[model samples]
Each structure stands twice: as C-alpha cells, then as structure tokens.
Target: MQTAASKAPAFRAASMALPVGILTLITLMVLPIPAVMLDVFFVLNIALSVAVLMAAMNAMKPLDFSSFPSVLLFATLLRLALNVASTRVVLVSGHEGAGAAGDVIESFGQFLVGGNFAVGIFVFVILLIINMIVITKGAGRVSEVSARFTLDALPGKQMAIDSDIAAGLMTSDEAKARRAEVATEADFYGAMDGASKFVKGDAIAALLILAVNIIAGFCLGMISHGLTAAEAAESYITLAVGDALVAQVPALLLSIAAAVIVTRVTDKSDLAGHIGGQFSDPRSWMPVAVVMGALGMIPAMPQSVFLPAAAIAGYLAWHLKKRAAQPEPVAEAPPVSPDRITMEDVSDRTLITIEMGYGLVHLVDKAKGAPLVARITGVRRQLSQTFGFIVPQFRVRDSLDIDANAYRVLLGGVHIGGATIRNARVLAIDIGDVREGHAIEGEPTFDPSFGCPALWIEESERDHATAEGFLTVDPSTVIATHLDQLLSRRPDALLGPEEVRALLDTVKEDSPGLIEAIHPDPLSLSKLTRVLRALLADGISLAHPLPVLSSLALALQQTQDFEALIDRVRIDMGGWIVGKICPYGEVLPVVTLDARLESAILQGMRDPATGQPIIEPDLAGMIGERLARISADLAQRDTPANTPALVVQPPARRALNALVRARAPDCVVMALAELPTSQAVEVIAVIGAEEEQAEPQNARQEELAA
Candidate 1:
C-alpha cells in the first residue's frame, strides 16, 4: 500500500508531461528570453533531436519505436518555437553585434563561418535545401508508401493468424496478441506518414524565419542606430544566418531520424546487430573481395586504396567461412521435471475431441455452458454408462481451418467425420416420415450422421416442418447427434490401457477373486485390455462387466489360447446373448444359408494368417442384399427390437462377420454351437434357397441389441 501511494503522484506527473511540454513550447514562442536562457533552450533542442535520432537508429523494427512519430511532432514544435524566440532576439538587438541572440548563435556566425556573413548566409541556405529537398522528402514518401501497404495487407495478416488457430497450431490468446501487433504496426506507419510532414514544414519555417530576421535586422540596424551599410549588413546578416543555422541543424537531425525509423525491418536484435549478422555470411564477403581485387588490378584504378581494401575483405571472408564451418556445440537437454505441464498440461486430454468452425462457435454459450456442449456432455455420459467405463472427458475447441459453419470430430488427432450446418437453423431430416411433395422450403443438405436427406431451415419453420411429419432438430442436436453416431460405431476405439486399468480397478472393489481368474494369472493388463476391447468390438458393454467377466472366467477353464478363449467366452454367454433378442420367452428369428451355399463359403479362400476362410465379394454382396430386405420387413412388424440373427457353422462365423458388418450392421451373425438349448429358432429366410444368401454382422443378436 505504501509503495503504491509513493508511485501515484510520480505516475500522474509522467502522464501530464505531454500537455505541460506543449504549454512550455507555446510560452517560448510568445515571450522574450535573456541570451543565457536562449543558449540553454537551444542546447536542449539539439539534445532532444540527437536522442530521437539515436532511438530511431537503434530500433530493430519500426513498431519497436512506435512513439517516434509523436516524439517527432513535439521535437518539430520545439525547433519552431526556438526559431520564433531566436528571430525576435536577433532583430531587436542587431546593433549589439554577433552575440546579440546567444553564444550558440554567435559561435555559428563568427566561428563556423570565420566572421564572414556572406559565407554564413550561403551555408544556412545549403543546410535548408538538404533538410527539405532530400532527407525530409524521401522520408515522407517512404512513410506514405509503407502506410498504404500496411493497411492493404492488414486483412490478410489477420486471416493468416486465424488460419493457424483453426489448424490447432496456435491458441486464441496468441491469435489475439498477433492481431494487436499487426494493428499497432499499421497505426505506427500511418502516424509516421503525417509526422513526416512536420519535419518538412519545420525546414520551410526555418528558412522563412531567417529571411525575416535578415531583412528586418538590416533595416533596423541602420535606421535606428545610425550605422553604415557595411556595418549593418555585417552585424544584421551574420546574426540572422546564425539563428537560422541553429534551428536547421536539429531539423536535419530529426529528418534523418524519421528516415531511419521508417526503413527498419523486424529482426531479433537492434539495427546494428541485424545488419552485422546478415553481412557475416561468408558467401557475401568472398564476392566483394574478388570484385575489389579485380578493380585494383586496373592501371587507372587507385591500387593504393583498392589493393589494401581487397586484402582486408578477403581476410574477413576467410574468417567468416572458418567460423561458419566450425560445428555448433550441442547443448545438453534439461532433465524432465515434475509439476509443470507433464501430460496434463495438454489442453485436450480427451481421446475424443470436437473442433468447431468460427460460425458454429455461437452454439456453445460460454455463460450457459453452450447448447452443443450440454448435448455432448449428455452423449458422453450415456456412452460411458453404456460401455460400463468412464469415457475420457471430451474437448470442444474453435477451429478456423474448417468451414465457418462446419465442425469435425477427431479421435486421437485424426479427423473421423465433419459437415457444415446453418449456424442457428434447425435441421429438418427426412426420416421417410414426411408426405410426398411437401411445401416445406429450406436449404437442402444431407444428415452428417445417417447420410439421410435433410434441410436447413429457420427456427420459425421448425414447428411447421415437425407438423408436416419431418424430424426437426436444432443445430446443436445435429452436431451432437452426428458425433454420437460416429463414436458409437467404434466404442472399442475409445478404450485404452488407462480405461482398462480403471475398469479393472473398479471390478477389484467388488470381485477381486473373479478378476484374478482371468487377469495376471492368465492375462496381463495389456492382454486383458485386448480381450475387453474385443468384447466391446463384439458390441458387449462393460456396463455390466460381471456377466462378461464371469463368462470370461469360465472360458479360461477350457483354453488359454486368445482366439479359443474368445470363442469359449461367446458360447458360455449364449443364454445372455439370446435373451437380448428373444427376451427369454419370445421366439427368436433366425436366418441361415442353404447347405451347398454354406459349404461353399465355409470352404472359400482361406486367410493365410488366421486360417479363417475369406468370403468372396460377389457372394458376400448377394447375401447382404437379401438380409437387408428381411431386416426391413421385420422393422415394420412391431418387433424392431428383435432384429433377426443368422446362425452359421462355428468354423464359418468368424469369416462371415466382416461382410455382415459392412452390409447389414443391424443383423447378428452367431455360430450354431453358441445358441442355447432353451432358445427357439424360427428360420426367417434360407438365404440361398431362392437367390443369394445372408449378410455378415456378428455371432449372436446380443451384440447388436447391446
């Protein structure tokens, strides 16, 4: 508290400095001053100009010295005010000789021009021409051109920053800072463009002040003091030139500073270091040395100078090359430490991540936790319960890499699926429920999840669409639904060693003995992880792990082989699997291939690695088409939950699973041996009886219904 109080007055005074300085400049222009005061003000003016020039030259980039333009403005005003005061003193006391204005002005008149007024007048004009015509004019043009280019490219630089953000290469705060820098750079250049005019005008004003002092002083010296023409001209002309010279020196310094500031390029170091590092390249110096050597050999050339310069250049080139060739020392990497970042430092720890475009960002209401985010949280909770393990927390981030209205789901940084949506519009999906040729008008699109026809319509039209029998879903629902569908298909993708370990840890609290039968005794954590993932792949959830674990323990009693163990586990869980489709009392709908077709497929091309026969693509396609027809027929029979199961020979079940997965994902493929004795089977279709056979999915309808 005491420190803050101490700083308050000093800080307030610093903030008031500019306004106070302006008032002082005004006072200098309006009031008269003694010769001593005039000399002190003159010295301060020159010091300010030199300081500004040093600051400009030392800046590595233009923006590093962003205050240069404002400094130039005040510095120009100070010079102009000094000119006004000096002109007054010179005119009023012309008969008093060279020191009439000040010691500084007197030094310029007598010492600088050797007591000659003719030479002093000529030298002052020359300085004025250089400041106005050369340095100030060039700096003005550079600043003007730079300002125009910076403004033109502003939009593009902002877009590039946005691109990096969308690509997940940079975060939001980095993007914000980058945008601020680009705006500041443009503003700096624009100010420099106007500030250059101040320097140019200052040069012109200095010339005019000299003219007034000389003309008025010359007349006043003779008319008021009874002086001769030679004496008046010597005294008046010399003093006028001296005062002008005093102002022009600083004006020229300021012009050079402006030029230096505008021309700077961004670099890691100050201007001197940047230029020095660039010239350190050996290839650049070698050429310079060779060119100098060639020029020195000419008889008309100045060998005395060129020969020595060439030798020096060659030596520098050799030194630079030696330095370049020296191998860089490898710095030892710091030992990995704890508590900073580790794996948790990664913002996205979720195995699953949703990246949204800028347009869809509004769907996530930060204060209310966003509608889409809420939906995703619900989906994750549902999936975690269904899978019987806590799914990792998901991350939702804004990305500019994708379409403004689109979003994508990434599983381990790999894009799974993405689609565009109307920001706040509802999606009217045609789920084969709408009437033919309905009058509902909207932007036509496809459902990202199901590939069904959908329309993007205004929220007001949602009620109308729903009334017309179309399923109306909001944009949040659309994205959430799409993500849910894609993730649900591959639940096994979400389970890793960590999730498996967590699952086993939970199981241990209840049945440590049961876990012991199938875990470390027969399977390690990695092996157990694979076994559980395989069960998940078979559509069996760990939600109720006891039945799955109980079945696994029984399977291990017969065989320790991975494939044989999986097969045994399926057979042991036969009753539980059939109960999902038939509900213990209901009759189960079964599909099978004819004797010859089954034999052909069972005896088809065998996999060299697994020895399971691979089904032919044409034969597989025919079976899939037939099964899809039967599945559709059963869907309308008020028994959609009892999706039909195909019972196949044990040896052929593994071979046929992939084909069914692709063709009829809803149909379950089961081995006949895996079926329970109490379950009743009604063969819905003999796939090859009429034409082609059934599709591939999985053994037992239990996985399908899970």
Candidate 2:
C-alpha cells in the first residue's frame, strides 16, 4: 500500500532539519566589521589550503608523522613547493589577471611586507597549531574504525557454522564445507570494499572544489551579473550568498555536507589504517582529494564561511593526535614455575624398577657397566602377599624373558607386565607385518574396555639403589630374570666424588626453590578438598586423584590460574574426569594392595617324650595372627574421619542399585571399604533396602560376609 509520495515527505524532512539549525545559529552570532576585516579572508584561504594538503596526503596513504620527524619535514617541504608552484602557474597562465609572474610575485611580496601579511601570517600560524592539536587527538579513530570494519566483514554464516560445530550441532565435514563457502563470500566483499575507498577519495576532492567555486560564483554574480542573493534564492544556489536566507545557507551547507559525508564513510571503513596493507583501496585516496580540494578553495571562500571550514579541519587534526596518545590493552596470563618435575619427567628405568619390586638385589657394579641381580624367595612371597598379581613373581633362580620388540617384560613367558607396551612412551620403535592377530598395530584403536597399564615414577636420587635391589631370579621366586653382569661389578664406579658433590649441590639449591613454588600451602586445604570432590564427581579415581589434586592445590596455593590448574588436572588424570560419575560413589580405584599375610607354620615332629631342643617348633600360626592384627591396626589408623558414610543422594546413588541389579542380580558388596563387620552389615542393608527389598538373597549375603 506504500506509494513513492509517502517516502517523499520523510526524505524532505531529513534534508531541511540540518539547514534550519545552521541558519538559526548564524543569525544569533554577531561580529564587528573591523574584527572580520583583519585579513580574515586571507587567513581562511591559507587554513583551507593547509587542510587540503593534509587530507590529500592522509588519504593517499595513512601518515605516521608523529613518531618520525623525517616524514613531517618531507610533507612540509612538499606543501611549500606546491604553494609556490600554484602561484607561479596562475600568474603565467594569466589566471591571476597579471601579465607576468613577476607581477604576481611582487603582489605576494607586497602582501608579506604590508600589514595584511602580518595578520595572515598570524592566522596561518594559529591554523597550524590548531591542526597539530587535532592531528594528535584523533589518531585512534582510524584503529577504532578498522576494528569495527574487521568485525563487520567477518562472514556471519561462517561464525554460525563454527558455533554449530562447537556445540555438536553439525557434522565436521558439513561445517568445513560451509566454512569454505563463507570464505568465498568474504573475499568478494573485500574486493568491493577496496574499490569504495578510491571512489570516496575522489568524491571528497570534487566536493571541496565545488564548495569554493559555489561561494566565489555567488559573490561574483551578486556584484557583476545583476543577480543579487535576494533574487537568486529560489533555485539551488550554486554561487556565494549575501542576504537571502537560501542563497548563503545552501552553498555553505553543501560544502560542509560534502566534507562530513567523506569523513563518515572513510571513518567507517578505517581506510587510513588499511592504506599500510592495501594502498589501492579507494578510501585511502578520498582523504587526499579532500585535502587537495580544501587547499584549492583557500583563496575562494568569504571570510565568514572560510574561517569555520578552517576551524573544523583543525578540530579533526586534534582528534587524530589524542587517539595517537592512547595505549593498547594487554592480556596477562598466569605465571608458570620452572621448578617442578611432572609425571612426564619420570625415567623409564625408574618405572620398571618400581613395578617389578625392589628388595632382592645382591650387588651392583659400574666398573664395566654390569648390574648384578639376586632374588630372595622370602621377599617375593612378601610382595605377593602385599600386592596381588595373577602372574608368578620374578625368581633369583630363573631368567626373565624380555620382549624388547614389544617393550614388555614377561614372567612365566605369558604374563606381560610394564608401562612401555600400553603407553605411548616407546618413542623409538618398529612394527612388523603379520596376517594374524599378533600383527603390530600402527595406531592403537580406542577401546573403552582397555585401561592404561602404565606406571608413573617419581623423580628421585634413589632409582639406582632401588633398581639394584629388585632384579631377582629364584626358579620358584620368579618366572625369569636378566642380570646385567657389567653393572653388578661395582656400583661406586658410576660417578667420582667431584661429580657426586656437584649433583648434590645442584639438588640442594633447586629443592628449596622448587618446594616453595610447587608445594601447596596447608591453608588452601578446604579449596583443594572442594576441587577434589568435583574431580571425583567427574569420574576421577581415588588412587590417581591425589597426584592431580596435589598439582591443583599447589597451583592454587601459589596464586596461579584456577583454569590452568583445572586443565593440568585434566591432563594428568586423563580426559575421563571431564565426564560424569555413576551412583554409589563407585568410580573404580586405579590400583589396590592386598595387605594380608599367610601363615607358614611347620608340621608336627615325632613324639619321643624328649622335650628340650628335639624339634623346631611351629610358630607360623602365631606369626600369621600377629601379622593380621598389625595390618588391621594400621588400616584403622589410616581410616578417614568420615568413612562408612552413606551416599544417599537420590538419582546418583539409586543408579548404583539399578546397575548392581543388572550386573550382579544375586551378588552384594557394601560400598564402603574397611568397615567393621556390624557397620558393613548395616551398609548392606541400606544398599539392598533389606527392610523393603528383603535381605540380599543368597550370593549377595555371602559377598557381604566375605
């Protein structure tokens, strides 16, 4: 239903509002005749010329004259040369109404010598000062505009596509294809934007010249064409104005309009900054044209209009100067300490020693690089009792089969043990081809059922000693063992006294600084505990949590980044901590130790009525009982303050009951560890909901009792 005439009223309303305001202001301002007569016209002419040169140069290529004195000097020299040349050209061409260049030169000399020159010179100096102020003030406008333009030019479609990809709303391939299409659009827009700059540059120049001519033509027509401002007010006044409201107003308005429009368009694009990267962009040239036009119009405008034009130019320059003075914002990140050796820094040799067991060494030798190894049957038994293993222990009487190709150590020629095979630590390796299941896989496929069988060793000076103690070979004690004979000859021959002292000194110096920087303060325990609970909820294991939690606690205590600590914790604990934990607080523990001791009582001897020293008495039963009691006491001492606590939260805990029902419909084991028999029974009752669900039916009761 909208018509062309309907839009007409809106357009006219916008056009008239500005002119009316200008007119009203002009009428209110009253000036003295003599004050205006102080060679004001000449001063304005000079100011306009200066503005023209500056704007033109700026648009040609953004000027950075503030920091570099040479650039400013070069510009000044060019301006002076151009001014002189213009004067000479006008006089030679007879455009100045002079027969010779000498006459024009003489006139210039006369003006300089005469009183008007002093006033003009003073005004020109004032103009220069004002221009300098403006230059320093508005420099940031270019950067600001450039920033806006950059954001605007970014393809919105691409941004959306990226968001969708991040939010898991789109397939990876689709996102990539869409991003490529978005890039194509950006390139097209960029090309058009470059062309706009040149157009803008030229248009600004034309506008300035037009303004000067309009003012000159109006004055000329009023004085000599018998067309005064009063009668020439009706049509669009392309000439200077005097008394008639429309005549003077529109001409001035048009000139200001042209300048303002150029300023705005150039600002939005920030062509000034772009000039460094792309001199071909049209916006770069627009400022140059504006500058040139202003310079040419210097001698043409009336004092009243010309003065204001000069003032505006000066203001613009000030803005540039202020912007130049502003500083940029900088992002500060958390500081990292260089003192700590993380899990990654642990040595391969150290890890192997810890995993294989360490107390069976007989001797060590470094003279010929031989490491002698011995196995103790008693220690192997002790290890088996303390830490449960499905495979036979390394024995002093047997040789260990070392699978170097697979980076695995095997006992009984079947049970593979070690971190190198499961972890990504075999940096230098070779894979052989095979058609069967034994073929080496180049990249291990992700398996949810697979767990990392890697061991993390702490950095310490005791690795060598520990390694010496653990290599055993007793046919019954170990399935196999390899003793490095050269290393077994002499352990003291590894490093001399001086080298050992130096190593000790270095450690001494670094240890304190490292501890100060990496160890968590006791005061941050509460915060660390909260973070630990959060990690637990995210499925991190209790056995592995301490190391990660320590790292986080240290980072927090040292006032380091919380986010960085979180990220570090994630890295150390594996990405699983980023996921959810199931009910019953039942995240699987990384590893568990069996601390039970078995009895070793001797069998009965012959009954001969002789009592004293007849046979070795059996003490194994008593020893076993005492050992069991000792273990129990130790466990009680290690018990947490809130142990046997129930996790009764609704959905999270209930899920455990459901899972247990599905997995072990008849098996029941209370969630809490190391509880008294009575307490454990109570826990079973709660988990099974005995009162309502009935006591755990057969197998469940047996598991609870066990």
Q: Identify the candidate with maximal lDDT.
A: 1
Per-residue CA lDDT of model 1 for 15-47, tens digit only, reads: 999899999999989999888999999999999
| Local distance difference test, each candidate | 0.85, 0.34
Error of 1 at 317 (Å): 2.0
Give the worst 10-residue stretch by lDDT in candidate 2: 591-600
Candidate 2 structure, TM-score to reference: 0.21
Against the hidden reference, what TM-scores do the models get? 0.51, 0.21
lDDT agreement of model 1 with the native:
0.85
Cα distance off (Å), candidate 1, residue 277: 2.3
Off by over 4 Å in 2: 1-40, 48-271, 279-706
lDDT of 1 at 667: 86
Q: What is the lDDT, from 0 to 100, of the residue 336 in candidate 1?
A: 70
Strongest candidate by TM-score: 1
Candidate 1, residue 5: how far the Cα is off, in Å: 2.8
Error of 1 at 383 (Å): 35
